[model samples]
Target: MKKNRRRNKTKAKLTTYGEFLILLPLCHKEHQTELLEQLKSAKRPAFILGKEVPATLNTITYGQLDDFSRINQEKEDPAVKVFSILMGLSQEEVYKLNVFDVFGVINFVRSELDRINKLFASIKVAHSPEEIAAGVENLNFGTFGVIDWYAKRMGITNQDDVYSVAWIRIYTCMKNDNEKAEYEQRLNKQYVEKAKRKR
Candidate 1:
């Protein structure tokens, strides 16, 4: 009887479809801010619970981009919040999802975020390999920021049209804007330094 009681219980794995359904995360401003903040905050080093340990471990998952529960918003992992936004699943859906499926959901969200990070790889921001890669951290803000950037630079007043464009196109415009800004900054600094030398 004791052995039977102690037996390990088995659970079913996540179900499969023809292909995973993945879409760009919500483009709303508030959603974007929440999503970005979740990813940003997830960077804090994890610690062993109820134990003294150094909090120096830095973990970065591929290409280094980085979520759930309603039980308590304060104590819940950031991923929980992100899942609701990125997966379009409500807290109830998540609560009912299988443990294995939860991981699948988390990975799906990360992949989408990873795709966003790849955009920063070739931008004109950083010089060294490390520096360029560091843009991943800097550019993780939500889509609202990107849209605002395009509007400010391209003089786009038609809000509907702007919002309808594909996320990649919007991101490309942002990349171009960043490159241009860096170039102008470099040019101005050179002139300023030259003037100082002549003084």
Candidate 2:
């Protein structure tokens, strides 16, 4: 009976420690300072319940803080590169973006790159004119979709800017005569619509 009780007590203490770790990341810097102080004050009593709780929690919290800073630093440069290349922004402009905005831009570019890669793969294996046409259509759709998404995300309503940033040169590399003409027509229509909106 005593052994069972001791085991259950240890389990409960571990559960509490787990909860503390989970919530630690959600705390603001100021709140985290307060939490650290509280943990220090509670450590003596916590040792009575379980010797591991307070020391383990402190070590984990400090490790998480270091990791958080390191991750943000690591992500910054790659995020800036993606923004600069895809959006045609200068490095200085990319550097001005906040961490959250940088992350959003990186995610958008990564997903769009995946989509474009898949479209290219489909185009490569196309056996007939019809299959090629279908692939071209899919590719065009994804291209324009990405441009539209970027326009919205960056608040760029200017059609010219959007076109300049578009991967049209890369997109046209594998196109046939008919597919190229079709894509040109779509772009012209989009330009016309954008001009009308400006008026």
Candidate 3:
């Protein structure tokens, strides 16, 4: 019984470490090698991002890569537009992110989702509302990381202020889907009116 428990614990640790390694993104070329070396020297469970799995020439997970074989799609413009509110760094900050810094993470997540199976790809990766919900849940986890990163990078000084704005925008978006859609449609209508006047 004790031996079985030990084996199960080891298996659980390995799985978590494996999944964590799969999800990490290395920022630099040398970071990968450095990570592997550090993991080896410490003789501890660790994951490397942006780096090949140690002792294996095969890069990329076969299962995750094969997920891209299915059809890819896009989401509603309004959904994406409103989603971007939570997705992007606020313009009010003193340390504005560079274009690359701002969009780089977004693009990387897109590409990563592209590699996943069709059933589990991304926001657009989902065709049904239920599927979209699941994908959005996964996407939200990623977005939350970005918001936290921004807070750290900007020296937010007040966690409540940052979190409050995030919750407000998220609540507004989710509170009334129909109303939000109508609001966006109204904005588009006004834009069209302005364009017609210009013509």
Candidate 4:
């Protein structure tokens, strides 16, 4: 029983170390060689398994390369519009993101979407109209729009700030979908009035 437990612990540690090695290449290229050397020096105990361990790290290396290629390919994909909408970034800014930074932003947006979806799901499951109303009131919608409006009013036009402002406005409207149509109509009217004044 003790031997079995020891073997299991060793297997878990090896699996963790293997996963770390697999992800090391995703780091900046300048650090890749040093990381690889460190990985090589981290020795794992060889225990008998049904299959022979591969002699080379070629498979893991290829997987990292494939991920890099996929990220580059995705830059041209129409689905990137979703990221732009979520993050309030322009397509041009999104295209400029480093692959790792893009991955991080994508993950952040995905998690936020999941949280928002769950909130709506809870609102749907409420038993009474009052409960639903309470849920809706508690929902943190429109805060991003307020922030964006304030930022733009203050004339903060730097690229990052501009994107953030846009993102907040879009994200707020998306979360408040029932009001978005009316909100857009109001925005169009405002734009038209501004254009008329300019004429």
Model 4 segments more than 4 A misplaced: 1-79, 125-199
What are the clashing pairs of model 3? 26-49, 67-116, 67-117
Lowest lDDT sum, 10 consecutive residues, model 2, at 49-58
lDDT tens digits by residue: candidate 2, 89-190: 555664443333344444544454566556546544233577676776455555455456556756878644655542433334444434765677689979
For candidate 3, report its TM-score: 0.18
**C-alpha TM-scores of all predictions:** 0.40, 0.29, 0.18, 0.26
Candidate 3 lDDT tens digits, 5-91: 577435433433324244336335564454444333332112222222222112333222222222244632221222133233222
Please write out the lDDT profile of model 1 over residues 67-138, one tens digit for every residue: 221224477644456544444445555555443345444555455555556665666465546766877556
What value of lDDT does candidate 2 attain over all alpha carbons?
Answer: 0.46
Candidate 4 versus truth, CA RMSD in Å, comes to: 19.1
Cα lDDT computed for each candidate against the true fold: 0.46, 0.46, 0.38, 0.44
Q: Residue 89 error for model 2, in Å?
A: 3.4
Instruction: Name model 2 segments beyond 4 Å from true.
Output: 1-76, 126-199
- Looking at candidate 3, the ten consecutive residues that score lowest on lDDT are 44-53
Instruction: Compose the digit string of candidate 4's lDDT tens values, residues 123-192.
Output: 3322346756678546544434434544565576542443333333433444565366556868997999
Order of models, best lDDT first: 1, 2, 4, 3
lDDT of 4 at 111: 49
In candidate 2, clashing pairs total: 0
* lDDT for residue 7 in candidate 1, whole number 0-100: 39
